[model samples]
Target: MIENLWKNIKKKEFSSIYLLYGSEAFLINETKQLVIQEAVDLDEEDFNLSSYDLEETAIEVALEDAETIPFLGERKVVLLHNPFFLTSEKTKSKVEHNVKKLEAYIKEPSPYTILVFVGNYEKLDERKKITKELKKNASILEAKKLTETELKNWMRQRASYNRVEMDEAALETMLQLAGTNLFLLTSEVDKMALYVQDSKLITKEIVEELVAKSLEQNIFSLVDKIITRKIDEALRIYYDLLKQNEEPLKILAIITNQFRLIYQVKGLAKTGYGQQQIASVLKVHPFRVKLAAGQAQKFTEEQLMKCISLFAEADYQMKTGGLPKNMIIEMILFQLNHDLRK
Candidate 1:
């Protein structure tokens, strides 16, 4: 886990070669920063720190720098970014990387240099020998998105790190409001931590008061209200979104997307697919799948299809100027609520 790796890095237990690869930019960036902060002093950054874009440069070039002695410092930190060769994806750059040199370097890395490979890729080419060798030799961190449980734990840890207590309801509310983006979540938690510093506790009310909802989250809540048959609350959220200058067509698109997800999740669940399986198949976060699953329970497949049809009609009317965009959404909401009541 990244937490274990972070703890080790904090203790100054350095690894000679580090591999950080995944789709999550926040995790990759955070781990890289933590390594650099713990490995070298500010004064040594000029001579001891180096970065190379592997797409434009050869791997051996970085290896040569890694082998070189650090000037005015005991250790050197070399950041190797965009190691596209590690993954199956091909890059536009024609720079030829000498994989043999990388393989040999991995086998016997320079003790005086901290070599970090930063591949912002979802997965590496596991069939490649160099990838296998590096995995065997280096400290690895696959900085992927965290699961719901992992996210909650990480938020708790972040609050604790800031000397604040985040209650369970607050955590859930934060997740609901902010979605699963780690960068936004970190900012919200830090801001709330500072807000409740005097009390040293974050309650659900504090979270509701502080965390700003994204457009997508607002759409989700609007859908949630509709599902619960709370037309007033749903309209209120829609009005609030309009006051914030959100386009009605954009809102309609997201509402359509959410209903589509609910339809897909419902169908998949009926076929015995688990939440993670559905998430993987749909290429969405598991938490989103979980929420869609709950919303799916309140809808039959046919009802979801009808909701999607209404959204489609709304989209057409908004684009064709048949009705005012705001009225189109309002009408769709009312139509959906009326259908649910029947």
Candidate 2:
């Protein structure tokens, strides 16, 4: 939900000091731009729009201005590009020396002045006292990456807002191809949207043509087949991917997940874990859990137990560099296929 902060952004409620720090610079920039657009009238730079790179300057210019009145001209926005100020103990302490100087100003930041701090640091010590003060005194919004579901939502929203309609399969395909990288997905989705302008409904076929195919090659269907004891279909898909250059370990990973799901679902169902609980236990989306749980019926409790050992062996082999990754995966598929047919 926090990943969708841009959707919840309200320009009017802009805070005095904003800490925009994250790997997802898109959110940081998008939110900052939205706030700036709302706060400043576009007529001219009535408020001094100053951007500072902390590597170059102390907080004196940025934090000190907190006391000064808006020049007769208008409000001044001091943009601190890098809060290396809060970076290390030495740098952070040097910066913290002015907590009072900043605190005095933060208490009543100039109405016309907006201080923006962008740390972009890899880590934030939320436990530190000064960190607590900065976080508490300012609007500390961390830009988090989107999860799979949230990424799906993002792709749809981006297409719809841009007047492009991507169907469910297409969106799913896009998500698969895009992986979890929001920044890359955002750009790729936009590019595809512009290309498919002629079509209101972007179909899976169109997605296949327009966007890149997913890495696993939709091996989820194979996951479904193997779990349902549809050995024939499962092997068919497995062989298809292998012939298409799909690595064995990759396929093994997906199949291992399948049996693990069966064992999980059966265990949970026996415990009355219900769909929701099973989904949570498996860390899979609920709809997917529901399907896997239904498919779990094909696996006897004994079969599930036995296969767990097989999967364990495969995982060990893969992790220990015990076998070529593909052979390790092929062995898993062969075991699952043999057991299913038996």
Candidate 3:
């Protein structure tokens, strides 16, 4: 697992060749930074650290650098970025790579150098000999996006790393408020951890107070309020969004998206699809599917379809200047509230 590999790296357990591949750019970047930070000193970076874009640079060039002795340091760190040849996808670059040289290097990598291949592609061409060789010989990390459970655990780990304790409610609220981006979550967690340093505890209240809500998250809250028959609260959220200069049509778009997800989640659940399966089919985060499932329980298919249709009409009116955009969204909110109340 990536976590174990990270632990090993932190302990200064160096590997000759490392393969970091996957769609999650954050994890891949994090692993690269961690390796670089641990492998080389600040002063030695000038001579010991090298990064080559495989799309533009030939494989033999990077390999030769990797084979070169470290300058004024015991170890050398080489980063190979965008190794597109490892994947089946063809790049626009006409630079031809020497795959045989890379394959040979993988077999007998330089012990004094740390060769890191950063493949941002989602998947490698597994059938290729170079990929197979790296898999067999190198320390590998497939930095795919974590699932909901993994995300929660990662949050807890981050908090713990900062010597703070986060309650379950705080964790869920953090996810809801911050969304699933690791970079944002990491920042928020560090901020909150510092805030609760005295008590060393992060509660839901603290999270709500400090975490900045994205526009989509505000729309989600607006929908939640509407579902619970709290039109006043929903309108307040809409007004707050407008105060922040959010475009009416953009807010409407997210509202429409939230209802559509609820509708889809409701329908999928009826047909025996679990949250993860539904997330896969819809190409969204599983945590989003979970939230939508809860909201779906309060909504019937007809009600959701009606809500969607109202947003569609509001969208058309807003675009054609039939009504003021703010009034259009307000009217849609009232209409949805009135319909849901029935």
Best by TM-score: 1
- lDDT of each model, Cα atoms only? 0.93, 0.68, 0.91
lDDT for 42 (candidate 1): 91
Off by over 4 Å in 3: none
Question: Which stretches in model 1 have alpha-carbon errors above 4 Å?
Answer: none
Model 1 residue 278 CA deviation (Å) reads: 1.7
- What would the TM-scores of all predictions be? 0.94, 0.60, 0.94
lDDT of candidate 1 at residue 87, scale 0 to 100: 85
Q: Which pairs of residues collide in candidate 1? A: none
RMSD to the hidden true structure, all candidates: 1.7, 6.5, 1.8
User: Which candidate ranks first by lDDT, i.e. highest?
Assistant: 1
Worst 10 residues of 2 by lDDT: 89-98
State model 1's lDDT: 0.93
Candidate 1 lDDT over 30-55, as tens digits, reads: 99999999999998899999999998
The parts of candidate 2 lying over 4 Å away from their true place are 1-14, 19-29, 33-103, 110-113, 116-153, 167-188, 208-213, 216-219, 228-262, 265-301, 318-324
Worst 10 residues of 3 by lDDT: 331-340
Models ranked on TM-score? 1, 3, 2
Question: Please, what are the lDDT tens digits per residue for candidate 3 over residues 1-342?
Answer: 888899999999989989999878889889999999999999999999999998899989999999998978899999999998889998898899999988888878898999999988888999998889988999999987789789889999999999998999999999899899899999999999999989999999999999999888898999999999999999999999999999999999999999999999999999999998999899888999999999999988999998999889888898888778999888887888888888
Could you give candidate 2's per-residue lDDT for residues 164-267 as a string of tens digits? 88788887777655555667777877877788888756667766786654544356667666666676686777677877887776667766676677778888
Clashes of 2: 1
RMSD of 2: 6.5
